[model samples]
Target: MKINSMYPPGASGGIRAYASATVDGCLGIRGIKVVEGGRDGLFV
Candidate 1:
């Protein structure tokens, strides 16, 4: 599986970022996770 991250060009209303993942170079999935509170974190 491979994963990549992408940041919004500017403000995204409430979304901060996005990410995508692919498995076996065939199927793929994308989404975001919201952390209520944290100092440092990773999206994917």
Candidate 2:
């Protein structure tokens, strides 16, 4: 799996960034957001 990540302008706090992933040269997934969690840590 391949992943890309970024922090958009004005993004802050819990929801702070965005990402995308590609699998086996497929068109793959996009616009996956990143958020901060209390205990479970970050999730896709």
Candidate 3:
């Protein structure tokens, strides 16, 4: 899988950022969320 883009949120709301990625160059995924996690700190 490869990341297409990662954009930070405009405001803080637990979510750290937004992301997009491709898998195996044959599939596409969009609007993947990245957020805060307990203990782990960051969630993706």
Residue 38 CA displacement from its true place in model 3, Å: 3.8
The list of candidate 1 runs beyond 4 A from truth reads 6-17, 34-44
Clashes of 3: 0
The Cα error of candidate 3 at residue 26, in Å, is 0.9
Please list the residue runs of candidate 3 whose C-alpha ends up more than 4 Å from where it truly belongs after superposition.
none
Q: Where does the lowest 10-residue lDDT sum fall in candidate 2?
A: 4-13
Residue 41 lDDT (model 3)? 94
Per-residue alpha-carbon lDDT of candidate 1 for residues 1-44, written as tens digits (9 for 90 to 100): 88765556355544555667788889887775433234665333
- Please report how far candidate 2 places residue 3 from its true position, in Å: 1.6
Ranking by lDDT: 3, 2, 1
Model 3, 1-44: lDDT tens per residue? Answer: 99999999989788889999999999999988898886889877
Q: Each candidate's TM vs. the true structure?
A: 0.40, 0.62, 0.81
User: Tens-digit lDDT track for model 2 on 1-44?
Assistant: 78854656364668767878888878788888877787998876
TM-score winner, 1 or 2: 2
Candidate 1's TM-score reads: 0.40
C-alpha lDDT values of all predictions: 0.59, 0.74, 0.90
Error of 1 at 8 (Å): 7.2
Q: Is candidate 1 or candidate 3 better by TM-score?
A: 3
lDDT of 2 at 44: 64
